[model samples]
Target chain A: MTADRPLRAGAGLKPEHHRHILESRPDIGWFEVHAENYMGAGGPPHFFLERARALYPISLHGVGLSIGSAGGMTPGHLARLKKVADRYDPFVVSEHLAWSTHEGVFLNDLLPLPYTEATLALVSRHVEEAQTVLGRPILIENPSTYLRFEGEEMAETDFLRALARRSGCGLLLDLNNVVVSAVNRSFDPLTYLDTFPVEHVGEVHLAGHAVLGDIEAPLLVDTHDRPVSPEVWGLYHRLITRLGPLPTLVEWDSNVPAWPILEAEVARADSVLRAAGEGRARAA
Target chain B: MLPLDATQQTFAHALLRPELQVPVAVAEMVGPTRERRFAVHRNNVKASLVATLAAKFPVIQRLVGEDFFEATALVFVERHPPRSPVLAEYGAAFPSFLGTFEPAVDLPYLVDVARLEWARHEAFHAADAASSSIGSLAALADDDLESVRLTLHPAATVVASAWPIVSIWTTNTLDAEVRRIGPDTPGEIALITRPDEEVFVHLLPQDADRLIAALADGAPLGEAAASVPDGFDLSTGLALLFSAGAVSGLLEGMSE
Candidate 1:
């Protein structure tokens, strides 16, 4: 795990709440920002990001690195990521495990990847390339996948563990994504979490997902628009209780509510971490 | 199973083309729910990119009603999905697309208005540099002034249009009332700059774009000023530039 991981609970920063967060100086553990938002040469995004960086530890997360792309990664994106990472020196830097670009077209979503030996090697090399350019190791988040691919290869966890071991990168275990993927794929969330490479997990993401279609076999979409779901919260608590509280972030990107709402989510995660820490201390 | 690259290529190809069948690879894996699951990715890609366009070109979206804008935008997205992930740089070709688009032919000014908005977007995110005050120009002698070269601020841009785009942009972006503009309205030159925190769009007198373009092309003040038409308000143009902090630094002529 990276030494710069923020162990407490944090909130994803939204543009709407930039002024409010800076003014109020909320007592949150840290702030996570999407790297794509700040890639512009200079503007309000940079201005507010600099101010926010001064007040809180920031985790730079990239949604567009396209690490799993077989056509290779997007050109110049790594340099852009490097610029943001260099500017912010974020406590932790991360990107998704899925590809969003193919044949020179950026799809703008975290599309899934097949877990094959070829993909594992490609992703590992891409992660190494990113770490080499940024001069620091980065964490790879498990994407909230909607569908699986037909392939004869390893399980998702095995692939991720191998990628981490090969590339020396850490894992950003998004619990909401775990629940979302589990429900959509008709798998047990607990079993998946039980097998996750928790030792390599440096951070955890808890976000709200939208359940659409049939009530019995709903398709869980990783919407990140509302408060964290109870199922996700339960998984988060279970993970923290066992993993001893990695850095947790509550993400609400769309239809964002007031700062207090997001702050409350962070507070809830913080309390969970505190309880887990207390339990550990009692055990000691 | 498809090769890794072929799998991504097939998946990506089908994502943009909804009419195509979900790849047999994905279909076979997810079973009956495959189409709905595949639609999730399709919806996400188009919706997010459309949302990005909407955010970048709000005035374009407003000028045409939301439905028209989105309908046209979907066509644009399919034909020209972003080549890069930095969405701020996505719609560089949109203004030109609007110009040739048959649906927008009635509103001839739509293309230029889109250009003006794109210019404002560019200026808003261009590299930040300190603007040199007009006080420096005052130091130059009358004869030396024409030879002096001024550096434009990095965030400054000149958007020349054949319609009253500045007013259109201003009215749409701000809380101002909708001022009626006619077909015969004279063209305006928009000077966009973000000297400090806010992006300012100032409508300069006609033909100011020529001088600004010349100056931006590394021409000295005299060379650029000479290229403009007679009766052109050099003072108004220079004043707008300096007031907006568009002038960054001055380089004395090499003739000296």
Candidate 2:
């Protein structure tokens, strides 16, 4: 998959755009899919994915692996993920750093985890297990946190860097998540990126967020329902300029718009990527 | 500091029970803003699960109004969270949960309707299998037909209900025309099959349900037809199975 040139900008694959994508064959970089949606035995999801796989490079972004859970990963879930990975041979396989299942109950949402030694060890162990099962290193995306945990611990960046070092897995740095988490926790997004170990980043994610709570003290929810916000787009430009161009994705999960609208987002990302490449070439 | 397991358990408890305070470790990070920050995670968990259930049981949601359905779904979400990561297979226990729910007792048919929807959901995701051609069966000798045991398609499911659930499901899903079902409506037996790519729901004769059920349980054709009620036409059942493309294969004498 990497035998060609570097990865390019893509969009999160939605079922509504499957036919249009196949028919139009747009110039987007690639497509990403939620691994859980394709875990079924067989159906239209698989039917469309098979055709899409033939056309573009596919990335498997999983939401429910629960890598941060202390109980360890479920065998069944791991097996199903392996089945999908083996079938698609995805160009990149990624999962969140958050845990979703606890005590046999799946919350269906990515729950936050505390940045502590215990969590680092737990997450690393889980990542190692997943890599062993999949026979390939998977990229772990930093989660968008709503709340933080109180404890003597390392910073989230240090924890993720250590996790990558220990498990030999790369990072999927979601720029929108950084913006949301920074705004929610009252931190500087640039400082967070400055301290981030961007060398380990294998991919980048850009998505939209919703502003909630009172105006005096609002919170940014990573809703992924609309176009990438201006602030998030600015962050994406800065990150790409710093780390050079990485495979970026335009994720609009909920309230997905028409084909042209989503394609427009991808085009915007592609343009930024080209500009970033030009700047790097001039500097070199 | 609480152990990792204890912290997770406490967080989960707080998410499910609003009255409970956020775990001390989690609460301290936000200071005075803890309540609002924690509510986001709580709301996301509930809202996502409720949406999942609503998608799986749309007919039930329509049968009950939107407000009632959301309320009932929230209750169900609290009582029974998903046990699997696969959202498509998340609400397997909902039909039984609806049967015991207090508010839904007045609408007894609602439980069966949920069951029918669940059946269709299952059939839609079941494994793909090629249906046995009628020519393959025609090649069999007359003497060999009775001893053959037929296998239904992997995606085929038979849901028998004491209420007219087939009509209820079709009327609500296929047509927008509102029509009230009388209390005297007869019972129904629905056969859900995904012969090719699309899932289809066909209402079968009352006796065909028993015959199909027996055949699904690995009974030979002769014995399965004999077990049906007297005057039950075996040919009709065979025709229904063939037309629906539900029969996947046939084995002689039930031997592997």
Candidate 3:
């Protein structure tokens, strides 16, 4: 078994910059790739991923596992994910708390689920199943919500805490999601984070959000384009200062900037991570 | 209050069908109205899939204007939502869908163009394998040539079209200039291969696909070469196949 390597901060791997990354060998913490993007049998994705794996620690973040599906998880997808996980042997493997599949169709978007006892039970069962198939404890991320359900019987943080405890899985705290959900749902972001089960967090994600609608009441969309916002950066500071450093990833999925621009984001995140680590060291 | 199963089924149904009302369970949030808020998920489901299709079929999008392509893609997305979570495999049915799309019917060759594009995509992601060279075939004894069955690389595929799709795909892709393809333009066969990890689209000679099809069917070299009509340019075909590294191996000991 490979020993777990430490990852401070990393950038999402983009196909356009794969060759550049291999050639330049940029000084970043690690690289995280969407598990779905590398699910292909063989090609440039695998070719570059293999080379990158040799250079840096890798993390597999899944976007379509649909672990919260009410209809239950697909065994085929779980098997395919296991194949990828075994082949890459990434330091961390994480998936969203949202479900993207309904009936038989994949919606290609992380649809939110109600925070209820039944929902928690379903997600925990699926998460356990995935963990068994993957042969490892996976991290479930807090989703970015646009609307709430009246059927919700519990708080989002309660649901996540219960999920992690029950399934023995870690949590991937996406700070941008916190800000987006807070703004959309009329809640304080910091208050929500205070109640979060930080001890269970294995990784962190920071990204930029798009603000839609009017200034009086803005709707934040988790569009991972552009750089991380100051608000999310502040939240990351709050989390890292308290939680110490984790494997933080700066995600820019669409409108992916050039390598230098993306590298700057990774660099900034690395600096924040280093400062937090030093602060924790001094306190100890 | 709706249960988890009912809530998901209702939300999912409303997400795909915009005409349907947002499920009653989705309460009014702080910022936007429930309809406006739920529209976010609606927009995300269709827009993201549309974006995936657009990325996969850029040449098709280029052929039809962006608006037309998006309109047609939205229809295709609704009609054939992806069955798998891998978005890369989402648009396998798009070529056939375009064939019947009334708005794109005027561009008769669009379907073939989409096919060539899809072939390139499949070749880009197909299983990686070592390719055989012409020397491998030459090394064999002349007596063994009849029994030698050439195996195409896993990434190799032949797309034969009645329209000049190769030129259409090329001009639109490499050169920014869009040339009008006349109805009288000659048909072409495109051979897509990713031999050394880079996908290349080559215009093959007429009826080259038949040789590829025969070889792909595990036919022996001599029989596959003979399957073509007179003046099949067997030497050139063999050279092209080997040079592109499309021939992965040569098999023998097969009974005819």
| Strongest candidate by TM-score | 3
Clashes of each: 0, 0, 0
Candidate 1 lDDT tens digits, A214-257 = 77558889999998999999998888888797899999999999
List, residue by residue over A53-108, the lDDT tens digit for candidate 2.
99998999988889988877754798899899989878889999998888888888
Can you give the TM-score per candidate against the true fold?
0.96, 0.96, 0.98
Off by over 4 Å in 2: A1-6, A281-284, B29-32, B253-256
lDDT of model 1 at position B133: 82
For residue A168, give model 1's deviation from the true position in Å.
2.3
The weakest ten consecutive residues by lDDT in model 3 chain A span A1-10
Task: Give residue A123's lDDT in candidate 2 (0 to 100).
Answer: 90
Q: Count clashing pairs, candidate 2.
A: 0
Choose 1 or 3, whichever is better by DockQ.
3
Cα deviation of B209 in candidate 2 (Å)? 0.8
lDDT (Cα, tens digit) per residue for candidate 2, span B119-140: 8899888888898877777788
- Residue B120 of model 3 has an lDDT of 92
Candidate 3 C-alpha lDDT tens digits along B33-125: 998899898999999989988988998898788999899999998899999999878899999999898888888888888999999999999
